[model samples]
Target chain A: MAEGTTDVPIAGYSAPRPRAHGSALHRMARRRSTTALLMCVPLFALLAGFVVYPFFYSIYLSTLNRDMTRFIGLFNYQYLLSSNTFHLVIFQSCLFAITAVFLKALIGFILAHVMHNITGPDQKLWRGVLLLPWVIPPALSTLGWWWMIEGSYSAVNWLLQQVGIHPIAFLSSTAWARFWIIMVNVWFGTPFFMIMYLATLKSVPDQLYEAAAIDGATGWQKIRFISFPMLKNIISITTLFSLIVTFANFDIVQILTAGAPANTTHVFATYAFQVGINSGNIPMGSAVSLFMFPILAVFAIFILRGVTRRTREAI
Target chain B: MSSATLAAGAAAPRRGRRPSIARERRWALWTSYIALAIFAVGFLIPPYFELVTSLKTSQEIGAGTDPWFTQHLFFGNYTSIIHNPQFQIFFLNSVKLTIVVVCVTMVISVLAAYALARMRFFGSQMFATGVFLTYLVPESLLFIPLFKELANLHLINNTWALAFVWPTLSVPFCTWILIGYFGSIPKELDEAAMIDGASHLQMLWKIFIPVAMPGIIAATIFAFTVCWGDFLYPLAFLFTSKQMVLTAGIVSTLIHGDVLDWGHIMAANILASAPPILIYAFLMDYYIAGLTAGATKG
Candidate 1:
């Protein structure tokens, strides 16, 4: 035995060393090419056992009617397409996603710029405080929103009343309900935009700004020519990712309203859970949920390819 | 750091006769500040309003005691909910499920990420990308099938159902993150260990696991947070009130049908959210790194 080495291996009788055993494990472990695949088994087993199987199973389940008895291909999809309930949910989902994404991006950008400009000693503290909504779980925060917007005890409504304005039914009325959901989403998601923009902003060469400043560039000119262009890719990537997330969002909607005020607030996700899980009509719910996948898949493809491209470029 | 430099940069200039451009920039700065303050208020008010409501009793809360005005802080709600067995079970279920899922996710993701990062075998890249894109498919799309499969396995309504199903969402993102983190680790460390007659598994257990501890921690936080906060999967799977995780338990059972129990509901919501909130407060850097790793690497 070498100095500082012992006959007792660290793993210690877990298995005979592959080299000593002269088995396939040795061949697999010694070769880098083979090692990767061998290592992949545990992870791949997880995916195969859980993700892929469930995914394909859901697709198959949707084709069948309730109770998994008879194959009724296209019936579930066609029904979902033709139903008035489905149309309303789909429209609400798009409205929710679009409104949330735009507000989050706009507000996040403006905040990031403000934080960048301020000469405060406690900048990190401000950023952290601003990030509170994101850090706290949505279920909690949104539940809080649910309480605050209580039809009778609504703080917002009371405040409006004090100002001589009519008390709006935030959670009870369809229009006010929709507005509040979008508003909550912007609160939760803007941190992501802020973080990404701030990170990208840190890397912008100060020289570009200095040169532009020297050339008598106004603040708007500096932002347009220097800052915004540099942030374009980060902006695009962040917005695209947020869109997919907000589109399929179940948490905010579920907690805030549970597709309430006569199901006017139903997104595809909540609608699926409502009809499928809550109501116990599994196939129809599966059909409703699958509606968001294809649209999201396109977004995923762009993101994956973009990541690969960035990695290759960096290398 | 930058701010000090900026202030110094401004002060170092001539004392008298501030330029027209500088005055114009100050105007822009103030305007931006106003816009930012208004936007921040939009972001800040609703949740702050909720906090105030949660602290008020039903009577005081309903008495319309000036919604914005702080009156009679009701911390008893927290204690009341904490004393409830149902709320306690929900908390324990959530904590238990999050822990087990995070462990399983780290194990699966580390091994898979190691393969995707270090292995150059055929189709590895494609497989890696596929895993992440699978993750991108919303939980809604998969939960129905997952519920059915779990039901077939007789795991439905079991809190451990999350021990089975959460990895469907978690593993992909976790794997994506670990691959990015692992890819950044130098191959020399593993190669040196391998050349010394160590098996790949040994290298992973002794060398890579230690070296990749930060990445592992990052992935663990991500896994835990995702599992902890999930409402949809738990709602879809768990049946009995006792088995319900925090998110679904509060959403479904606490609210009940047609009768909203505001006191218990708010208290349960606050209690259930405590872990993730604390985790985020401490490990913000790791949290952001884990999120962006999934986004950037996927």
Candidate 2:
């Protein structure tokens, strides 16, 4: 009401720039390039400060020895390559990421299908309730889980005894230590995948299923042909994105076990924090963290390709 | 068969739906409800126990007591945490830091997204692509060097330093999400606004922002949740008990030494996680819309 659209012609209507503001230029009515560039200054500046600069700085830091006085130049990287603990760190990180992501993806896919099958007002209610795990901060939730699963006083163990089963020491044992770590990760992460897959399911046209029904196609055949193909791209994309995140996850292991039972459960982030921050070995820590970069870069490239392709397909 | 064969399976359901098809769907819906009910019980376990633990007294939280049920309710846990000055400081610090980070992120992302999506300029396309690519940069890889840089500036071990570093986590994704929102707006709005002599800032303020409010809310929620829940930055940057925010503070301070206070810790956990939970509950559609928007559009 205040702007009065047609009555008060906006200020520059009389200014003569018609030729410059040709139909081609007026497509979104191009602003002067300078204005647009000026607007993006803060964005570029931050990326430089936070990502680009620190990335190079990490590479530089990784080259030095434990002391800052001398540059060892790839010695730290070579040292990590042969180190026994570092070998386990790399293996554990990959193992943790792949297993957690695979479980989360499978569970999320099933739950998403379940969510799609429900058609009523209660769908939103169920979705809101089911998504609670991803909603809580993992650090806090991990604390809750740790309290449940951890020690002599563990309620989970107490429950096990009530059922006449032996209480398993989740953290102290080697295999179970890894199991719980990945389990916590899947618990924290699965809702994200479910929600993403649910969105994918929603986007598929419903009529195709009806048509399939008319043709006497079984539900399994419909899924094998239609849903799987539609879900394939998003599944790959969400899985790739989750892979990068789970690979670098720090909070769960750090708080829960602190990579205990002799550092058997450490992923890259926790191990880096241990080597770099806790131990005060910056160079070694940098090298440990840097190992994740190439793998992350590969996953990221695939996701970007997927996202761009999806955008193109949507258009 | 339809002339277009399988490709035309998406052809509209003709007349009344087939009875078997309706029966199959109804059966699927019932099965899905049962499946989701089971999953919901599984999903709610940890939080339920956490809440149950919080409601029990400190003495009642051990192995002997039933973990699943709280027979005698105790509000003392909440009162104790509320009375603790240290927790008060941590909660207040989180609020302050998250507000500033969310505001700064929104400003940078909204402006940057508007420019990139609408105002074509030198390297704008690259910057737009850069926004998406930056989402791939894990905070773990950058934290070590960022810690060094913050220490060099004497910003380490300070709560406010997080205000600066936290935006790095949120800005890229928020900007990308906003770009999708702005990109989807019809170009005609822009051309009309431009011919009316409105400037870029004016158009963004008066035209684009109103239409994209949902996107802005989603991005804001994303930024707030990221900042509110972040562990590493505060844990690395602020080590002192007094300087820490909620998540790192609770983990580092509340759990000090060999003795565990299960009731107090669970109480604190519930309190610390309340903001994100509340936001998710209220603005769920916006939150999920943001997620889908980023995935499908951005």
Candidate 3:
């Protein structure tokens, strides 16, 4: 290591001089930092060109009319606001997100608690099993579910028949389609919540439980007062994350129903795709997609702020 | 043993908590087991049914054969797909695309992540936040304008066009993971090497990269999986069968206007899904830890 060569005043007072005039480590640091920066520039440029530019480009696109030459500022917005289909889609998107998020959180929390109560060996096995839905790629796994719910050869329908109930057309009927998609979304997502909650569960110190036990606290009491409070931040962040993703979900809705049954199941993304990419009406599609950004941005910002605040509090 | 057990039981309820607590524990245990069993079955049944269906013959499947039982083990479906040109082309295209995209993604991510994490510069925080937030931009919304951009660039039918595009989606998540991991490493290690007069490039290669292998692995897996499983991008970008990736190729060629070719379709789907599934099955701990690190460690 370099030390003590020439006397020189450093930041404030006189300090021992560095050992070597030009050190290999200093040269390495200089070279690597430059290399690292040089390496990063292209990626930053790529993101700027593709992601950042397209984001702003959509804003410009949203203002134009169908021909792409003429400007119709807010006309697409006016069309969206006035249309009955747009109104229905907005309502349905919320219904899909809110309902699925709530169910997933509740079920996930309970499942986590139950798993927490289980002993060694079994806990490890169950944890792996529970996370299977999340492990499989969403598109592929949802395709599997899609084939299962196919109207002609429906497995759930066959099961319903055995139970003396009429077979429901899960995908064909608008309401049933909405319900099943949300159910599948919940199923796919709850494991994420479970894992997060389980991790949080493990972090809650054993001493709190021991203290509660000393005070004659029941299991419910221990959980309600201790576990719930400890997990508030995670709960909020996870829920917010889930809400944005679910609201913007295109795959499940597209693959499951493709906005069929008179397009009753269409969320903003698929609906935008239908009007925009599928039909070549870029302006209208841009407007619809632009509408989704603000919602997601707001959710993301709020969640990030919450996370940072919690992090600050923790520190 | 019996006398000892009776004596111990007589002493156990002295505080009167044993019997009731035992009952409550039993109830909780039973309830937990039952709920877990129901959920386990619920999660298992659909995929299980799909597997069963995939193994059945087309005639058996169409004849309303009991999904639970197969008339005969038909490995012929799998064999026929292997012989099909379309299937083979799609498979090869997917492999080529996944490999190229992953390589490009890793390169961009490693360079960008190192800069964002270790470099002292203006706008690094803003850039990092922007990177993380980009992951939140679901591909659906972005694909519209991006599709037009490709059209303008004359890259719509290009298979390797994904080498340019896939990084946009992969880099943000991968870089964030890398930055988070790198940030957690102590600065003193770098400083000590600097004191010894080692070059920064050498230090990074010789020290930081090895120390952060898990992060690199996590990022690579994420990058590969996202590229491999991508549907919308491939669909929007590539139109011709020759240019198509496995996902779009299989759906287009097999489904063919809703006259579903179940045999070849199932075979192709199984083949397409096998890689990522195998990766996850073997490296679940890494995947889970990586995702958690991305999600909560941020």
Please give, for every candidate in the order listed, the TM-score of chain B alone compared with the true chain B. 0.85, 0.92, 0.88
The TM-score values for the models, in the order shown, are: 0.88, 0.92, 0.90
What candidate 1 keeps of the native contacts, as a fraction, is 0.58
Ranking by TM-score: 2, 3, 1
Winner of 1 and 2 under DockQ: 2
Candidate 2 B-chain TM-score: 0.92
The residue-by-residue lDDT of candidate 2 on A1-315, one tens digit each, is 112332234434533766644553444334456778889999889999878998999999999889867899999999989998888888889899999999999999999988988777788999999899999999999988998898755888988899988888888987988988898888889999999999989989999887777777887898888888989999999999999999999999898898888988888999999888999899889999999999999999899899999999989
Q: What does DockQ give for each predicted structure?
A: 0.41, 0.51, 0.41
Task: Residues A53-99, candidate 1: write the lDDT tens digits.
Answer: 87788788889888779999989999989999889999999999998
Candidate 1 chain B weakest ten by summed lDDT: B12-21
Which CAPRI category fits model 2?
medium
For candidate 2, give the lDDT of residue A210. Answer: 76
DockQ of 2: 0.51
Pairs that collide in candidate 3 are A3-A19, A24-B197, A24-B198, A25-B197, A25-B198, A28-B199, A28-B200, A29-B200
- Judge candidate 1 against the unseen true structure and give its global Cα lDDT, from 0 to 1: 0.77
lDDT value, candidate 2, whole model? 0.87
**C-alpha RMSD over true interface residues, model 1:** 5.4
In angstroms, the error of model 3 at B83 is 2.6
All-Cα superposition RMSD per candidate: 6.2, 5.2, 4.6
What is each candidate's fraction of native interface contacts (fnat)? 0.58, 0.77, 0.40
